[model samples]
Target: MTQIVQSLAEISKPYDALFCDLWGCLHNGVAPFPEAVAALQAFRASGGKVVLLTNAPRPAKFVIESLERMGCPKDAYDLVVSSGDAAQDAMFAGAVGRKVWHLGPSKDDGFFTEIPAEWQGQADIERVDFDDAEGIVCTGPFDEINEVPEDYRAKFLLAKMRDLPMLCANPDVVVDMGDKRIYCAGALAVLYEDMGGEAMYFGKPHPPIYDMARRKLAAIGGVEDGRILAIGDGINTDVPGAAGEGIDCLFVTGGLAHDQFGADQKNPDPELVRAWLGARQTDPRYTIGTLR
Candidate 1:
């Protein structure tokens, strides 16, 4: 684990591009971190490309809209690649001509609006036969999955036994929803996989989203992969995902873990950060009090 001073001015050697995580590193889902926003703007003014890589379940447009609402200026980022966008890509890549059973909130339907006209809506899999259907797409409600009854689980398992592949739109197991740790698509996917189902993920900690972000960065004349930097707060998603892609990561404290472990108890302890990363075997390139 490395400890770097939290001074944006010290970043003299401007990176070619920056891949920043959305939730905890940039904002706490409610407001944009003023420092983070300023830093991004500074980096861009210095000719650095900024690409925001988010694990948000919504598509790029929705994510951008949300950022705008949260006070992050449009100029703060060059491109936004969301898990929701990756999910849409995965849906079309494998199941173009077939029908899909979408299991998610109503708002998530917008994600599939771009899909082929023939590949939409839910249907009985057993009656239609396995070869005819495309696959199961899930963009689960952060609040609903945990409350599901055992019967729903049994039914979903039966669907899996029929050899239907499941494409998980959001790979986050859970996210902070107004002080609650709600279930996410990845958690349900894990359960499905445990029941002998084949699940494909399309979000953070997964490679496709990172690949897309990299491509977008390259298009904007951003730095090559070696000079790119990833800033995130979640160890399970952002940190590991960036590290897996061989990009440098700057971990922000005071997100989910800070709340779970009591923020006031330990705010600026390098040893504590090291222990947290060490437990997960994810040593980030830098650790900071906050991304801002």
Candidate 2:
């Protein structure tokens, strides 16, 4: 059974490096969670190295700016690694081809600013010339707050018809927006695959970003994979990603999947948490109601 703890202080001794997630664990897309921020600060105060690993489809600079805007203190993390930064290699190199169709919000336009590729905006997903396009890069939904995954059904069908491959910048299926859950780019990528289109993910639970995170960890005095603790809110991405890297994971109960485990920000049902973990065959080393 996963050890349930009230504070990360109870189990922070063994780990020297932390691969902590950003969105749900530290903030809810709008504001920073004070307890989570304190946990990371405490971990750092104890000489632990922190690498803020995120599946956010923007570069590290963009994420840092967002975190600062949300009032997440700078000292809480040592370095930031994002899937968008990892995908930049392919984005600039034209891994699929030069002509690409962008399938995300305009705010994320910075992703393609440095690259010299033709960007067919999200004007008409259904009518975009898929045959002429090399691939599609999805950072997020065109309208995350007002739309759902089902809204992209006809678009995915059209992409499938042309046998276009998609480069999914963020691998998160959904993120909690305060009390509501919003679909992410990964959800759209899955829908495209379900419609027989190829998809390439570049984030957590995938090797590329983990490889990048490991390099960052190595630069600041290396820690054994076993001694590095991975903490996050998502069972789908974080747990499996840590397990895939041979690192122990601390599952945060009050994050995105809290409702599934009958949990809230302040209290969580341990029995329900265990059942949910058991059902997924996930063996997280630790569990906490919130990051603190």
Candidate 3:
């Protein structure tokens, strides 16, 4: 457990490569954190490789587009590996000939864009209604999960009993999308699992995302597990995921955990920070604070 003064320059020195989390550490979903972005730019200028690893359900290209709109230059990081990309890859590898019924917004249909042309129509969930589907590839139903009617439970059970595997594109159960707690695919996957369905996750806190990040890091001459640095704000996903890979982690205090600890309240005391840090006792190497 190494606790430094929480300066990005100082903390970034020991590692030659950085696998950074996009949402909370680099930017809140809506806006870019100039200071954090500047730190990444500085790291890149100094010859360090930076890769943005996000749990966003969209593919890496889509995430890059979103970041660009938020003023995040493509050069800020060498490459990106999103949960959506991982999920799509898993789906293609596992279900080459099987039918997939995705339950998400129409915009998310792009996830199956890489499927073979012959399977494209069958791969598309929007074209065929849910009742005619063979399997489920859930990205997220957004607010629809809250109002899932009781009658739907039987249908979900039947799908599970048929051994229809579900791929959860986004493993984040919930995210602070602006000022609201929006549900993600992980929540729906959990529900399906509770109903005895087989579910595969492809995002943060899962090895596939980390494995993808590690491969990207290696492509750009990054260090091995012992020397890589993982920076993020979500403890449940980021901290645990990094620790599982035997990498060091830096936790940002201005993200979800901070809000959960009431650090956003008026006159938040240091005790809250202390308690939060104490709760994360299992994380091997960590520091807590804003990116200064």
What TM-score does each of the candidates earn? 0.85, 0.91, 0.85
Colliding pairs, model 1: 16-223
Model number with the top TM-score: 2
Best by lDDT: 2
Which segments of candidate 3 are over 4 A away from where they belong?
A: 1-4, 95-97, 114-128, 142-155, 261-270
Model 2: per-residue lDDT, tens digit, 32-131?
9999899999999999999999999988888899999988999999999898877765666566556788889987877776332333442222213555
Question: Best to worst by TM-score, what's the order?
Answer: 2, 3, 1
Residue range 1-292, candidate 3, lDDT tens digits: 4453456797677888888888767876778877788888899899888888888888888888889888887778898889987777777665522467777776686786645343455433333455666668888873443634233477678787778777889887776766656677777788888888888887888899988787767776757777678888777888788888888887776777656546443223456656666776644365556654
- Would you list the clashing residue pairs of candidate 2? none
Comparing 1 with 2 on TM-score, the higher-scoring candidate is: 2
Evaluate all candidate structures by whole-model CA lDDT and list the values in order. 0.72, 0.84, 0.73
Misplaced by over 4 Å in model 2 are 114-131
lDDT of 2 at 27: 90
Q: For residues 168-208, write the lDDT of model 1, one tens digit per residue.
A: 88888766654556667777788888888888887989999
